[model samples]
Target: MKQTDEVDDLLTRAGARWRADQEAPPEPDLEYMLSGGRKHRRWVPALAAASVAVIAAGVIAVLPDPKTPTAPTAQAPSTTAATPDARTPQTIAQGNDDFLVKPGDKVQVSGKIIAVPGKTPVFCPPLAVPDIGYPPGKEPAPSCPDNFAVKLNGLDLGQIPGLSTIKGVLSGEATVTGTWRGGAIDVDVQTALKPLDHPAQTELECPVPPGGWKSQPSNISSTAVTKFLAAHAYQATGPIFRYPNGTSRGAPVVILIGLAHGDADAFRQAFEKVYRGNYCVVPTLLSQSDEQRVTNAIGDVMSGNPKLGIYSASGPGLYGGRALAQVTAYTPEVKAALTPAGLDLIRVIPQVRPVR
Candidate 1:
C-alpha cells in the first residue's frame, strides 16, 4: 500500500493492538514462525481473516507484578486512544517489533518493564514471547493477560523505578527513554505506554463507480467464485476493513484485490461477472504464489539457523512484495545467515537493535 495518512493511521492503530490488550501485547511462546513452515505455501499468519491490508501486530509480552494473577488473561480490544509517541516515524518504518530506539543513542522508545521473580523489575523490550496467546477469533491481536511475554532482547537491566516493590509481571507498555551503556540502556524516562484502538479505515487505488459501490444483481456460488479466482491467478489477502458500516444485513463483505499481472479494470470486470458482491481490484508488484515461493524458500533455509533468534516469518503483504521476519536482534550473524536471494525477498526485524 502507499502508506497514505489513512493507511498510516490505520496501520498505526493496528499496531496498538500489538499493544497488549488495554495496550499491552500478548503472552510468550509467540512463534512468529509460520506454523506451516514445512508447508511453505501459506499467507502470513499476521494477516488476519478479519480484514484486508491489515499488518500483523507487533509481538510483545508482560512482566511480573506484586500481585501475581495466575489465570491467563485474554487479549482485549483496545480501550485507549492512540496518540503519536515521541519517537521517529522513519525509524518505526524500519519495522522491528516496534522497538523505536537504536542502541547507543539517548533516544526515546516504547516497550515494557516486568518483574523478575527474585530480582528487581527491569525495563525490557515488549517483544511478544512464547507463552501468551491472542484472543479467540482475533488472530493477530495479542492477548494482554497479567502474564504477557517480555523478551530481554540481549539486555538485562536493574534500572527501572519502584523495582524493590515489584513482585510479578509489570502488565503494560512503557515509554522508555535511555542510552546504551555496556549492556543495559541507561534509563532516562519511563512511563506507561497508553494503548489505542484499531483504525477502521481503508482505501483503494481504483476510483469508485458512479453509483458509489452499490450491490449488483447476479448469481455466483462460492465454489465457482473460488475456481474463477484461482483460474485467473487470485491471491488471497488478509482482512483489513469493514465496508457499509451499520448494515443490518450482517457484517459487510468488502473484497479488496491486488493484481500483479492483469489490468485492474479488466480484473474487476471479470470478477464482477463471477461474483455479485463488493470488491476492489488494484495493481500490485507480487502475487501470492510468488510470495509463497520466496517465503517457503526462507523457511527452508533459515529454519535451523542458531542464535539468530527467528521469532516469526511471514510472506509478502498487501503493502509490498517483501516478506517480514521478526527476530531478536539484527546482527552480523543474522545478516550472514540469509542467502542473497532470500535476503532480496525478506525483511529481518529485530526486537531490539544495537547502537549502529
Candidate 2:
C-alpha cells in the first residue's frame, strides 16, 4: 500500500477505536529535551483524541533507525519559536540529560531525539524513584509515545533509515549502541526509554471564593488597567466548571495578580470589581510571596475542572513573565488543547494604568 493510503487506513482504524471509548483518553505525555543536555518534564494531560489519531497514522514511519545517523521524523506541537543556530552544537539534550558526543554516538538501537541542545547533547536522566505522580488520566502530550523512538529537536533531516517500528505506546526502557567508522564512533543504534509511570489522582474540594463575588470586567474602566483585570476574572468561589462527563467539577477561588509589587492593588481591584456581582472574588491585598502556593492554586483549579485557567500580569507574585503580554487566561489542559481550536494564550505587557 502507498504510504498515504496506509496512513489513511491506520487513522481510520484509530479513529474508530477512539470513538468507541466511553470517555476520552487522558492527555498524552509531552517530553521536552532542552538544549545543553538538560531534561525538564512537566506533565500536562489535556490532549484530544484527534491528536492521537494523527500519531496513529504515520507513526510507523517516524521511529529512529538503528543504522541511520539521524533520529525519527515525527513532530510535536510547539509554542517555542525557532532559535538561530539552534543546531550549531554537536550534542542534544532535554532539560538536564546530557550525552557526550563520541564520533559513534549514533549506536542507540532505537530512541527519539527529542531535542538537540545548542551545546552538547546528553542522556535523559533516569526516571527518579517517584514519591508522587500527576493527577490521573492526564499524561504529557506526546507526538509518538510508542515503541523505541528518537526525537531530535534542533536538526532536521528528510528521512531516517533503519527504524522498523513506530507506534504510540512507550516501551519504558531504552538501550544505547554504536558503530566505529573513520576514527569516530558511528553513533547509530536503537533503544527504548521507559514510559513514565501512569499519572496518579488527587481529590480535593474546590474552594469557594473568599466572598460571593466574581470579578467584573467593567470595574477597571481604564484601558490599561481594565486590560489587566479583564484578562482574568474572579469567579464566585463555588463550582463554575466541570469535566465533560461531570466526573470532576470544582470551584476554585481565582486571583489575577499584577507582575509588579506596585500594581497589586490595581490588579486586585480590577479583578474584584468585575467578577464581584456574579461571583465572589478574593483580593490579595499583598502580592503573593510563594510560587508553591500559586502552583497549588492552579493545580487545584485545574484538577477540579480542567477547563478553567488563571490569568495575571508578570510580577513577583506571579511566575516569570516572558511572552509579550503579562495578561493571559486559560485552563490548564483545556486552554492548551484549545490550541488546535484557535485559542492562543494571550500575552499582555502591563503598561501604566491609563489615567481615567
Model 2 per-residue lDDT tens digits across residues 160-201: 333222233222233334542212123344344323221122
Best prediction by lDDT: 1
**Per-residue alpha-carbon lDDT of candidate 1 for residues 190-297, written as tens digits (9 for 90 to 100):** 665532222222233334656666433222335667577556543333222223432222323344555544345655677777666556665433345444454454
lDDT of each: 0.39, 0.25
- The TM-scores of all predictions, comma-separated, are 0.49, 0.24
Candidate 2 segments exceeding 4 Å error: 1-185, 188-190, 193-226, 229-263, 277-356
- Model 2 TM-score on a 0 to 1 scale: 0.24
Candidate 1: minimum summed lDDT over ten consecutive residues — where? 59-68
